[model samples]
Target chain A: MFEIRWHSRAGQGAVTGAKGLAEVVSTTGKFVQAFAFYGSAKRGAAMTAYNRVSDKRIINHEKFMSPEYVLIIDPALIHTADFTANAKENTKYIITSHLNKEDLVKSQPKLEGKEVYVVDCMSIAMDTIGRAIPNTPMLGALMKISGMYEIDFFKESMLNVLRKFPQKIIDANMAAIQRAYDEVN
Target chain B: MAEKIDLLETEVWDGNMAASQAMRQAQIDVVAAYPITPSTPVVENYGNFLANGYIDGEFVMVESEHAAMSGCIGASAAGGRVATATSSQGFALMVETLYQASGMRLPIVLNVVNRALAAPLNVNGDHSDMYLGRDSGWIQLNAYNAQDAYDLNLIAFKVAENHKVRLPVMIHQDGFMTSHTAEGVKTLQDEEAYAFVGDFKPMNAMLDFEKPATYGVQTEEDWHFEHKARQHNDLMTKVYPVMEEVFAEFEKKTGRKFDLVTNHRLDDAEVAIVAMGTTVDTAMMVADQLREKGIKAGVMGMRVIRPFPFAKIAEVLSNVKAVCCMDRSSPGGAPGMLYNEISGALYNSAKRPVVTGYVYGLGGRDMTVEYLKGIFADGLENAKAGKPTTPLQQFIGVRGPKLNFL
Candidate 1:
């Protein structure tokens, strides 16, 4: 099973982002299970959303200890919690922050070199989405680094996921996902 | 053609094992569950089925109790014989759909491993979960040992699917007592059990592509009262008869006959204790000890609690000089949940015995048959005096003092 963990606070649409990713992954005929767990069980608390992708049925219902990919919507969370404790040597990290690759490495020295992909999801979110919610943009970085899905597929799925939201916000979030997908290189 | 096989020579399994076997035997199309104590074993066993390729179904590992019930509702409405398991707070979380499933009359059968609802939050066996849903239109059946858990579950699906009673059913077994308790139970053969469930052809399948219709219609007293009244009348009257008929039919097929209620040694008894679920075991053992002591004590086990079975409860306890009502539920405004109901049922009777209500084991108090002996002694005390109260109630086994607090 390919486990993808998303780190974000509540009310930041991380649950929506995880479910949206589920919708996209499901389009590829792969069985997908996406859900979230939190400690405080309240809004704005640091929470983890998880996804398990597999060819066969998944029986393990606990939190993922070993993840294939990690999408950090808030780079600040890296220091607050043990985000990479369960990560393997071959793990891919797609981080969303204002800093570039060299500065990010300087900030978190342990993350020096390990298939690391960076995206200015904050600036992208403000420019396109007009808000600080960077989950959609970070998800775009996931598509770029993981290459498990196409950018256009996430774009289409995002349209459906954000259909109930404001129309202007929808267009901007779509643009943010695309921008992150481009900048993750 | 010699297709169907006989039921007697099937494999013997334990109650917990029988529950898992029956879910598979029933060909459950979908299972959505979140892990909770006591109820966790069934889901864990079901997960093993998915891993070992025993059952052909999608299992959704949900985040919380709400999502678990929602997923099952979605699957059931789409014409699948869906099932889910829960206990305690998990059962409390499904309260909304517990009402919806019955209001929609979706014939959803849920297995509740009864647990104590907590303030300090205990995860042990109790009846608080099913008690919270007494008014919710689900047929409630309490199971004693693992064997009753196995037996009631088989009949639950049959009753729920009956056109006359297309309502949700809650088959409750005590959390650690019956759910975790290991005991021998007989499961029907695969081919025979399949023939038993037959095809789960829902009358109002919301997913029938060709024949479209609405279900769970929202209303504001136009036809709502009529629909509700019809539901209640059918559930109390029509369903009772159909329930008996189905049991008879099942006995013909599986060679196992079950009664709605079992009055164990009630005849010529001076006092009887009324209880359900695993407490019945304790009551039975206590009955034996009481007989040795020459107390003339007996046990009455409740099979159904939803339709209340008021008439039956009144009839059985009428002869006994006093009845001790053992309950695991606490009603905030009234006496013990079952106590109030039993008292109301026996209120008009000319020989209304002195009834005592006990609301112990709130969040798992480790109830034993000896406890029943104490309660029966209390009932006998009230009875031998030849004086009964207009309304009598007391929590039999509270911490310090027992009083009619409510």
Candidate 2:
């Protein structure tokens, strides 16, 4: 089973990102469970969502206590939340950060050993979508790191999910995804 | 909520979304809903469907949960296919009209996302509202996951609208635990689902003015006794049999079988846990782990809570040496509702098992695998000692003092 946990503020689309990923993955005939844990329903409150994928049906409905992959959509969560508290030894991180990998590790040495892929997702979203919603860009970073699906697959699937939006919004999100996919390191 | 999913293919849906699809495919005539946590999406998605011209239905935005059920009653009494959704306090608000819906024999299907009733005010998943509506005369069905949520809603419409069981049905899914969690759900083709539920045949419908019927009439001492007896005794007795037939038909159509009670590792087992909602899946996982360690742990998941499956529960649990009854809702000052019911089910059995009551996961607290293993360990010890080691009823993961009661 591949377990993933996502941390983000309420309006940042982490819940939708997790759900979108689950929907796309299930198309490949894998069993998946995606859920979000919410507190207050305000726009800026920190919240977490989770995903579990397996070749077999998943029966456990509890929260993912130990996740293999951690995706942080809100970079501020790195300092504000214990995003890595339950991570395994080989747990990988796909973080939406403005800081480079060296500066990130220099400031937070605890993140040195793990497979940490950092991207300027907020800047990417701003440059591409003209908005700071980093969820799609972060998902691109995740796809790039995990190789769970081809970047085009995520783009097409996400475009389908966002089909209701205006053409510009859709094009911008697609552009953000492509840039994040190419630039995450 | 309105992103298109290919209805022709199997798709991922949360419990709320799955139930919403059932409502949409069933082609419900009216949905009167008040937005509440964990339950809002069920009706919200329906509203989206209504907006997208995906369904032909009336979406009523009522001011409160009470008004929502009242609107459902109005629409249902008018011989329209009607449904609504709510959780916790919202459900509690509608308690007064719950009896009106069932007693009037209106077959309104209610989707109840089970959440804890508030004093501390929790928005997470629990069974407090489920237990609160236990005596409300609605035929209650519990879903452990997304698939069950989808399947049970379709079955509920069929069973509730049946001539023999013209009663309202409350389909319960653990609030956010199931409602907000997305998983792969096998869906029936819209035509197949509509065909399975058949057409709406409303009996004694208010709209049929040719054969006029009076609803909500006062029943004083003269005829109240017989009405109560028929409503509570005779008709309630018919639900299980009707459900059995419906289950059979659903399995034949969708290839998914449902029982009043679902068992896992129960055969030839010495220790078992009895519970409802999401906890059942967690207990089953723990039971499998216990089996790996050479312990005879089993799980009994109660699918239907009302018209309590007494005989089936007794028969399934009769052989176990120890049984733990998991109640996700708080009892406040009494033993958990499941505990009391299970105790009554086994009260006259030939072989008496050491039954213990455990109140856990109240207000959406997580029922971890570790906690479940500890519960099984305690139950096994109780079986070995032929009695409960701790109090007969106790709270599992609550903070502060270990609260126990007789």
Candidate 3:
């Protein structure tokens, strides 16, 4: 089983991003689960969402996870939430921040020895999607870090997931994904 | 005819969405609901379907959960298929009407997203609401995942509307754990699903004015006992066979087999964990891990909670040396309900196992894999000792202190 955890605020679309990832992975005929824990949480309050993918039916429902990948859509959550609570030794971190890996580690010493990748998902979303919804862009960075799918194929799958939106909004999202996919370091 | 919905062969859905789709496929005539947390989406989605002309049904918006069920009872008695959804406080408010729906023999399907009742005000999943409705004369069916929630809703209509067993049915899924969690659910086409549920056959419906009949008739001291006794007898004897027939036919059509009780790796096992809802699936996973370490572990889940499945439960656990009854609801002051029921079931067995009770996951507290491993470890010890090594009834996953009671 492969587990991924996302740290974001209540309204930031972590749950939507996780479900979108699950939707694409499930099309490959693997079982997937996406869920979140919100205990009467309000907007802007820090929260976490999760995704699990496996070849066999996934049945474990515990909120606790030793996540293999950690995606932080809200950089401030790095200070607020315990993003490393149940991390695996080889867990990979893909974070949305203006700071590069060096400055990020210097500011938050807890990530000193971690395998971290940086992407400006917030700015990417703002520039391409005309909004600060960093979730889709975060997924793009995740794809780059994990190599879970080809960039073009992942973007196409996401188009179907976002099919309900207007053509312009969908195209903007596609651009957001591509920009973050290429710009992540 | 209701408009058909085009769906993918597999759709990503939460438990609430799955249930709503089932309601739409069943092509229900009425859904009177007052929405609440977690469960709100089930009816909300149904209302959307109604608004989109996908359903030829009345979506009655009522004031409270009491009125929500009261509307369902009225619509059902008027000879239309009816359903609703509720949880926690909403369920508590519907308690009185629940008995009415059953006593009147109204075949209203209720999707109960199980949650904890509150003075502390929790909106998360637990079996408190499920346990509260156990004695209300409804045939309760539990779902461990989104797919089960979908399949069981369709099955509930068939079972509840059966002429031999005209009782309201409740399909329960864990509140947030199942209702809010999204997963890939294999869906049946609308035509296939509607055909399996068939058409509603309203017996003694008030709408049939030519054959004028009475409902909710007052039963005084002379007849109340007989009324109660007959209802109890039918629940004990009649519902099981009808359920068996429905389950068999469903499996034949859909290839998803359902039984009164779910047995996982129980054969040739020495110790087992008995649970319900989503916990059953987790326990089954843990049982597999335990087996690798050479402990013969297994799990038994109750699919049919109201009829209790006494004989089936006993037969399944008859061979195991020890058992743990993991009840997600608080027992208040006594042993957990499953612990008491399982003990009673095995009281006369020829090879009775040592049974222990565990109270866990109250108000949506996480029942991690580690806690299940600990429970299985105790089960192994109890099996070897031929008695409980831990306390007869203990709480798992709670903080502050180790709490146990007799």
Q: What is candidate 3's CA lDDT for residue B63?
A: 99
Ranking by TM-score: 3, 2, 1
Q: Write the per-residue lDDT of candidate 1 for residues B220-328, one digit (tens) a residue.
A: 8699899889889877897788778877888897677666776878877788888888677667767777889888887788888887888887877778888888778
lDDT of 2 at A30: 91
Q: Rank all candidate structures by their DockQ, best first, as comma-separated numbers.
A: 3, 2, 1
User: iRMSD (Å) of candidate 2?
Assistant: 1.1
Q: How many clashes in each structure?
A: 0, 0, 0
* Model 3 ranges off by over 4 Å: none
C-alpha TM-score for every candidate: 0.65, 0.97, 0.99
Model 3, residue A136: C-alpha shift (Å): 0.5
Ordered from best to worst lDDT, the candidate numbers read: 3, 2, 1
Q: What clash pairs does model 3 have?
A: none
Q: Which candidate comes out best when scored by TM-score?
A: 3
Ranking 1 against 3 by lDDT, winner: 3
Which residue pairs collide in model 2, if any? none
